[model samples]
Target: MAAERGRPRLARDTIVGWMVLVLFVSLLSVVIVVRESLHVSVTERANADVTQEIEEFRTFTRTGVDPETSRPFTTAERLLTVYLSRQRPGSGEVIVGYVGESGVVTTSYGAGAPDVDEYDLTRDPAVLRAAEQGTSGTLDTPAGEMRWARTVVDVRGGDDAMLLVAVFTGEGTAEADRTVRMLTLVSLGTLLLAGVISWLVAGRILRPVRQVQEAAAEITEHDLTRRITVGDDDVSGLAATFNRMLDRLEEAFRAEQRFVDDAGHELRTPITVIRGHLELMDDDPASREVTMRIVTQELDRMSRIVTDLLALAKADRPDFVRLGEEVDLPALTISLEAKVSALADRSWRLAHVAEGTARLDTQRVTQAVLQLAHNAVQHTADGDAITLSSDVVVDPDLGPALTISVADTGPGVPVAEREHIFERFAHGEPPDGRRHSGAGLGLSIVRAIAEGHGGRVDVGGTPGEGAVFTLVLPTHTPASHDHPEQT
Candidate 1:
């Protein structure tokens, strides 16, 4: 069956698009606020200028007298007419009138004046009261759509006159409106420019991220050599970290592939041997017994291979084996040493065997110990001393552990192959070019058993001084302890 799709559909480009949208929205909000502030400022300034003009006109109309003739006017109308006729064209226009003492307007700027008397100023209560009390008042005229400032002033001849100054705000209001429109357009243009720039900047920032994603997507099990180039920034750090992770993954993949290939090669050997032996039996009856013996040996070798593979697979599982009854470390070491001595004439000796106890699967522990001893014997000569020893050590960080060591007095492992000596199919050849006879699963199985028991194994030695292999197992602590006598 074809492999199911495992890649992500939303790529890095989709994320870049989202970032652009967010930046645009942020820019738009800023533009709106700035535009509104500008409009308000313009309107406020226009209103202030119009108010100042009204104030200046009121001061002139109230305090000014003719320079040539120092004569006061009889009525407010004559004074306002003189003021208007004498006013400069650029000095804003002012219209004056008078109301009775009871707040009645008896005279105005007269007829034939444009918008001078278009609206009744006295009809407005504020203006009428201002006239009665001789105070300044502002009125809104809908007909002219302008603001007029009215002040009641006493003429030089003691006649009460109402001074009306209509400050035309239509022009100023129109200017403010135009300014708002222009500001809005400018703000929108600026926002557009900013959005474009932000999009470009965001694209530049995400370029490395896109590269990383692309590089990762292109990396498959078959092709793990792809790498991403990064600039000298945070992206460089990210790229370095990613490359490190890829390095580890690649190493693991290579290790797994080697394991598979070696397993296959090892398995084929026994099958081929059995096939050859069985085929020879069909040619001669006298050789049938010899052929049967050869076939039996091949089958045994195949059985050992299958068994070791199963053990290794099981050891990989999280809960492959559980702790059993406590076993005495010293007793176990003695037994393993005796077995090694009997199997080979090598000088196998037990030393410094600590009286410690461990809760372990006894069968597996015994098997692991035997595997280590067998490896030691195979590597050393008949007369070489192979010392088997055990000790109880306390480490503050790791608590108590029972350590077992098998040291041989022969040539140690080579520097190049020392690290991988415990790996599958890593049986080291003899110094004289003689190969060891075994499935090469002994050390690997020993490692698996030690690790499965929450322990570890270490192997190291000087050249020509024979190697020392130590297995450290955690000491068992029972729930209820009655201290047993050390044997």
Candidate 2:
């Protein structure tokens, strides 16, 4: 118990933890993918803008005619100066021209614009070398990061020069960063909410399991009445099944208790009879012989009672009847008449024989029929007609059924006693006004055999004329035949 209490609550917290982790991983992946895509998009757009600007410069130089003079330029300085004067850079962009060792042209636009000297590549040897090579890359300046693309141009009668176009990308990158920050905040809030919801939902789902555990803890051998309250969700099926199991357990326990009670009650009479006879026996030989006979008879009666009680107890087992055996109904019925004919001095007759085969436990069916015949013999006098019959009939709910009946020319059972005649220890009186000598479990055993075949036993006949005890069983083999028959 202490170990069980100390164990982790894996069912509750572990489920919640896994849910939160999956949500966190999924949300984080989305954020990372979005951020990377946005950053890549910003860099690509800036690169395209810079490339476009450089391409325009190359296209103008190809014309070889100055836009301002409408004539061919004589020197590279004139060409460079004329182009720089005609240029209009976009927002957050700059245009610079590096002409040999002593000439520089610069233009800037947008807010926080740096002075021309700050971007004058003439002072920076690395920048000038990179620009001269027509390279494309990023550079950190007083105006923040810039993406630059450049091209070197060699014109006749002029110093070698380079044209550089740079786009200020700090604002674009800052916008992307801001978007990621907002997404991160939102995702964190959503994760928090998801964790809370997951915790509650996990608890709700596991509540039934906890109830089953608690109910099991409270239940004992003497008390099997605890049941889980069922709901309509998927988990409710488990609770419903558990309740059904409990119901069967409770019924089995009650049946065991009743069997013990009935055995004690019934066995007391024979024990008292034997004890009384033994106590009253005298020294005379005749008296002693009579007492011994009485004692032996009582002991035999007790043995029969014990056997009947055991049969009744075993009725609830899965293998009470060995089903799936094909037996000819007509032959089985005729054989029943032959077997029961010697039970008493009554007139035993075959009334009808069904002309078909059925899968059933032949031994159990024969045993039930013989018991019915014995019952009929007890109910009627000698020369009274006892009829045995079998037939194939159709039950509306059960399809084809095979019915075997034992009918007697004796008083029929009263309507009031029919309901419980199949119950254990329940009995009906015979016509001779003599108490029955055998245990009352004969009909119960018969009913058990019928039910084991997924069928039923019923009593039907005209009142006071006769009693017809019929066993109605399915003609086809039952699905429960998968269980191996017990020896």
| Best-performing candidate as measured by TM-score | 2
Question: In terms of TM-score, how similar is model 1 to the real structure?
Answer: 0.61
lDDT of 1 by residue, 311-341 (tens): 8766654444456567877678777777767
Candidate 2 C-alpha lDDT tens digits along 400-482: 99988999988878777787778777777544445666778889889888888888898988768899999898887568743
RMSD of each: 8.8, 3.0
Relative to the true structure, candidate 2 reaches a TM of 0.89
Go through the candidates in order and give each one's C-alpha lDDT: 0.65, 0.81
**Candidate 2 lDDT (Cα, 0 to 1):** 0.81
Q: After superposition, how far is residue 443 of candidate 2 from its true place, in Å?
A: 1.2
User: What are the runs in model 1 whose C-alpha is more than 4 Å off?
Assistant: 1-145, 151-160, 174-182, 230-249, 283-289, 309-349, 355-368, 377-386, 392-403, 408-434, 444-468, 472-487
Q: Which regions of candidate 2 are displaced past 4 Å?
A: 1-8, 75-78, 110-126, 132-134, 141-144, 159-161, 429-434, 477-487
Q: Would you give me the overall lDDT of model 1? A: 0.65
